[model samples]
Target: MQQPQDQTTTLQKTFRIILGVFMIAAAVGHLSFQRSEFQAQVPNWSPLSKDLTVILSGIVEAALGLGMVFWKKQRIKVGIALAIFYVLIFPGNIAQYLNHTNAFGLDTDAKRLARLFFQPVLILWAIWSTGALSHLTKKFKG
Candidate 1:
């Protein structure tokens, strides 16, 4: 459980920064070194070319990363956006598993299947770190 106070605790603040940095690093990978590997995760049904889809997601990741780190006033929104982003990209993860596409050291179906379970953790991390989970919970509570 996380503290639902208006201000985030030091732990949440630290984790948010860490997640931000991780996203930035992933963005770099998407744009440069891991371009081909990332293409492996792009679903075949996507309307955009794989390279273009990877590029767009890279841009989005970078923007969200920067927002998470520097946009304190808007982090709740950023966290929400990032959570949504994770949801949007989930199909790519599914495609990786279902298509038996090998990339990012997840060569086996078991590896890929395990990776799918981590997405929700990332989503929860985003929401919890930014207090969005509590905020959202409150919005729906009577």
Candidate 2:
């Protein structure tokens, strides 16, 4: 008989795959014609050139996206890593809102501020969709 945890894990795996595809699509936006749009999210205070930062982040996102989908044996590790990535990029989101820079249809301060609230959701999605929460819980409890 299949356990409840097994069903939950399967559901989480499916969600992880969906998140992986979303990341890959976003990475493509970062690297292609929308590159300049992505640059708007990079803080002016950043030491790196905007183009370089966008390209590097695009590459990293693509790798993480693929890893999340294909690296099942290491899914928990990938989930943790992706969560950290989301946290790291959150500053850029804040910079966009605070600096009044516009991109990806986030035209006004209200829209930008609203978007800021989604970052935590992405972080949680990464964790929950990969079963990383449960994995970490078990690791810490043992």
Candidate 3:
């Protein structure tokens, strides 16, 4: 019989798998039909041209999504990469929230405000699912 700790570990693993899949889908969905929309949502300070940004972001997001599926080491690398990407894109999310930039049918001001909160949650979810929190805990505990 599995111990309680072992059960928890299994639960955590399951959560991670689900979270990874969701993040991957989000990343891919951003790249799919919404590519142009994502470009328009970008803040002015971003480096890529509108079209290039769309294409490149799509590529990166898709790759990051796929990274969650590889071997353990690769998953860790991908998680770190994705965390960086999440940080980088934060401004764009803010721009959308502040400027009321409409895309992907998020027209309501309330919806935009809600989205401001939601993106960060997704980032946190990704971080937790990637086992980064555990690593941090271990580092701090030791």
Strongest candidate by TM-score? 1
lDDT for each candidate structure: 0.93, 0.88, 0.67
Whole-model lDDT, candidate 1?
A: 0.93
Give per-model CA RMSD.
3.3, 3.8, 5.0
Per-candidate clashes come to 0, 0, 0
Q: Give each model a TM-score.
A: 0.95, 0.92, 0.78
Stretches of model 3 off by over 4 angstroms after superposition: 1-8, 27-32
lDDT of 1 at 98: 98
lDDT per residue for candidate 2 within 29-78, as digits (tens), equals 99998899999999988899999999999999999999889987677778
Q: After superposition, how far is residue 104 of candidate 1 from its true place, in Å?
A: 0.6
Which lDDT tens digits does candidate 3 get at residues 60-109? Answer: 77677666655345444555577778888888878887778888787878
Candidate 1 regions with alpha-carbon error over 4 angstroms: 1-6
Minimal lDDT window, size 10, model 2:
1-10
Of the candidates numbered 1 and 2, which has the greater TM-score value?
1
